[model samples]
Target: MTDAPDRPNGGSSRGLWILIYCLLVPAVVVPLLVPLYDKAGPTLFGFPFYYWFQFALIIGAAILTLSAYVVSTKADARERAARLERRDRR
Candidate 1:
């Protein structure tokens, strides 16, 4: 069987995975800290600060999730391509 080529740095993608996790952490963690937004002052369009903040968090989480999805999709594609190339070389 033919040997596959070696990639630089052992083909590690740990950094990209870490970045993806970082991008998703706030989306999961922020909303759980209720004390940060548990207030009634600073109303927005007749809504309390707490209500508006939660709405904003929903939008923020969606954007962050979408970004994470995009990054992971690209990473997965690259990994798949590398695997396929290795298989083809065999």
Candidate 2:
């Protein structure tokens, strides 16, 4: 089998990663599925489902992104640091 190539960023690409796929869910899937929650039930503090759901989606997106970043940071700390070092040198 052919060996993996050394990447400038220090990690070789193994193609699509699941963690990266998760990063797209809140940004892509939620926005595309707006019809699913386009309702007026499930009120929150007098706010209708539409308004509250949007706010919840915003918070959910933020949390998902932060979680992904934290998980990825732990997983690729060395590779990311190396990439940053290379970038700053150029």
Candidate 3:
């Protein structure tokens, strides 16, 4: 067994990959939830459903970006704390 705290599971970080999958929800769900034609109703920029769909896409993208950032930051913090604890033990 290695002393490295980073490899608590036989050097396999499957949990990290699982975290990534969980973070992908907003990327997949937000666009589906946005009812562009029903919400925008008619047209806004002479683009029929185009304009509202684009807006929804942008909003969804922003949410997904934020979600990804939060997930990544949490993972980084967890790793940092773990490393700090390991250092303190040395």
- C-alpha RMSD for every candidate: 3.8, 5.4, 6.4
Q: Tell me the tens digit of each residue's lDDT in model 3 across 9-83.
A: 233334665677776775677566655344545676676675677676788777767777777776666666666
lDDT (Cα, 0-100) at 81 in candidate 1: 72
Candidate 2, after superposition: displacement of residue 55 in Å?
Answer: 0.6
Q: Identify the runs in model 3 with alpha carbons over 4 angstroms from their true place.
A: 1-47
Query: Best candidate per lDDT, number?
Result: 1
TM-score of 2: 0.61
**Candidate 1 residue pairs that clash:** none
Clashing pairs in 2: none
Q: What local lDDT does model 1 show for residue 84?
A: 77
Ranking by TM-score: 1, 2, 3
Which stretches in model 2 have alpha-carbon errors above 4 Å?
1-17, 78-90
TM-score of each: 0.84, 0.61, 0.52
Candidate 2 contains a number of clashing pairs equal to: 0
C-alpha-based local distance difference test score of model 2: 0.71
Alpha carbon lDDT at 59, candidate 2 = 85
Query: What does candidate 2's lDDT look like per residue over 43-63, in tens digits?
Result: 989999999888888888888
